[model samples]
Target: MMLSLALVCDHALIDQAGKLSVLGIFERIWVERFPAVHPRLHLVLRLKGRRTEIGDHPVTIVLHDPSGREILRGDGMVQIGEPPAGVTEVEAAAILVFDVPLETAGAYHFNVTVDSELLASLPVTVSQMPAPHPTPEGN
Candidate 1:
């Protein structure tokens, strides 16, 4: 299998009809105050299965802090169907939601795995960036 796409977004919504809608797509988290809840994070992944692959598979998503400590985890199943004639691979999409762990500002990693094999890692940064000072208007 190959990871075609992996991303971290603010929100990943799956409708009853199996439609996915994402919002607030971002790669950085800026907290103005200390010890604040980091809120939500959405893991979006797309994988391509080999033509010979066909079955139900488990997909795991793991998040780690800058120190390489695991912070959050999510799991879901993906059904891979046999590819059409002459096709090499088929694609399957998975979306997992996680409330980001509240901690000090630093870089984080969102990892996607299938069948115990790591597919991709998406990096996100959470920093307590200071507010920019306003310049004088009459300058």
Candidate 2:
């Protein structure tokens, strides 16, 4: 029930037009466990940035299996807004949700991209079911 995120900032580059500047990249990975009856896997993604219109940009999520094979991919637009003052970090924010089959358990990789450019990659492990308890009678 915990979502772990890894934020990486590449070398900053000044835009030629001076309109915007590239600061850093952020990535997160987490495992979600649902009730046994739940039919799918839900992945929630949240991005936070400053002076960036997350809604105006395109965000994509690519899912890969253990062997680095792509299994599923999805894209969507985010709703961007300004963050409170004094927040030198990313001000805008975006959230993405991906649903997949729960039966699919293994090492999965996620690649996040913007404008066809690779931003970040994340790997996660999913477990199928909890181990059963043994009875004293050995039945």
Candidate 3:
């Protein structure tokens, strides 16, 4: 007679998972009232289902120029929070203040990963500003 063994696991699994959604550049800024100058790129990440604190999760963002050459790389941590009772909405966010240089004008591609899992790859165009016209003397 042959016998087989079965293993079981038990844990409260959080419904749905977290992932990076939209990644792009903010073409304009409120303070500048025009296009952003060396503006920080914004990355939007969405987490579906109930929120739960998972400690700190490692996240990396890589930016590549139009030529496919790497321009910048950054590492950061993402935190998740639990929702209140009777709430089942998913969490979403827009993370900014990345260290990419706005001066490097060109099409950029972003690669984001979570815990070594590739989450998103987005492309954006960054244009160089032309020479500013001098303000005329007097009104």
Candidate 4:
């Protein structure tokens, strides 16, 4: 199997029809506007078939800070159906949502792995929107 997509978004959902719907997909976030550690987010990953994938596979999604420290880690089994021989590929997907402490602003990373194989690394930036300076005294 191979990684098809990895994303960070404000919201994500798998509809009843087996379709994935995502909103506010972004790589940069303004965190200081909200309370510290507020405004949780989601990480969504999609894997595609290469005819070698079958049954359940171990998948891990890890979030790290700019200092190379792990902020959070999530792992689970992804069930993938085997495609017929010499046939088109299929897909598997997973989602992890968590609140990150946004006390500081910097570059972060989302590392995604399938069966212990490094697949993708997605970059995310966290910065604060600068507050406006107080207006000078009016006449």
Candidate 5:
């Protein structure tokens, strides 16, 4: 199986017709201070496989901090079905929601694995938002 798309976004939706809609796609997060909790974020992944690989595959998502320490781990499964007669590849998609906790400003990573093998590594950078300076009393 191959990872066709791996991204961080605000939302991801799949319609009734198997269409994907992603919004607020981003790679960086700005916070006002350290030890910030990003409320919500989505890790979207799209995988493609051959028709012969039709089955349930174990999926793992691991989040690592800037110092290479494991922060969070999520496990799930994806079911692959037979492709259409004219299509040779099957597709699977998943949206993993996370309330990311950032301890300090640096680069974070989300490592995606399928069936015990690493498929993709997605990076998200967190930086401190600049604080506003004090206004002068007299101009």
Candidate 6:
């Protein structure tokens, strides 16, 4: 299996026909303060499977913080359907939702593993948005 696309977004969906729709894709998070909880995040992934690998495979996704600490984990299964008449590979789409809790501003990563093998790692940077300064009335 090979990873074709992996990204962090606001929303994503996979249609019955294997079509993927993604919106509000972003790699950085801006917060007002530390120890913040990002209400919602979406992780979208697309993978291609060879014809010989037509079966159910175990998939795992893990979220890690800047200090390499595991924050959250999600597990699921992916079924590699039989390829079309003359197709040599099959495609699979997965959408995972997360309630990301950030303790400090730094780099975070979402790691994807298929069949116990790491396939993709998506990085997300969390930073504090500077507070606005008040302007003088006369100026």
Q: Pick the candidate with the highest lDDT.
A: 5
Candidate 2, residues 40-116, lDDT tens digits: the string is 33443445555544346676888786677777788876555555676544423333434543335566677877656
Q: Tell me the tens digit of each residue's lDDT in model 5 across 8-94.
A: 999998888889999999989999999999877999999999998999999999999999999989999999988879888999888
The weakest ten consecutive residues by lDDT in model 2 span 1-10
Q: Which stretches of candidate 4 lie above 4 Å from their native place?
A: 33-35, 83-87, 137-139
Q: What lDDT tens digits, residue by residue, belong to model 4 across residues 1-139?
A: 8988888899899988679999988888775463357356888888887666667889888888889888888888999887667777778777788887755678888888888998999988888888878988992
lDDT of 2: 0.51
Q: After the best TM-score superposition of candidate 1, give how far the Cα of residue 103 lies from its true spot, in angstroms.
A: 0.6
- Work out the TM-score per prediction: 0.79, 0.50, 0.51, 0.86, 0.95, 0.94
lDDT of 3 by residue, 1-139 (tens): 0001111111112235633334332433222223344434455454333444334567787877778887778788765455667775534343534545544555677777766777677666666546678998994
Write one digit per residue (lDDT tens) for candidate 1, span 56-76: 778888888889999888787
Task: Name every residue pair that clashes in candidate 2.
Answer: 49-90, 49-91, 49-92, 50-90, 50-91
1 in model 5: Cα distance from truth in Å? 0.3
Task: Report lDDT per candidate.
Answer: 0.80, 0.51, 0.51, 0.81, 0.93, 0.92
Model 2 / residue 119 / CA error / Å: 2.6
lDDT of 6 by residue, 28-136 (tens): 9999998999977999988898899999999999999999999999998999889879999888888888889999999999999999999989999999999899999
Model 3, CA-based lDDT: 0.51
Error of 1 at 55 (Å): 0.9
Candidate 1: worst 10 consecutive residues by lDDT? 33-42
Task: Order the numbered candidates by lDDT, best leading.
Answer: 5, 6, 4, 1, 3, 2
On a 0 to 100 scale, what is the lDDT of residue 41 in model 1?
63
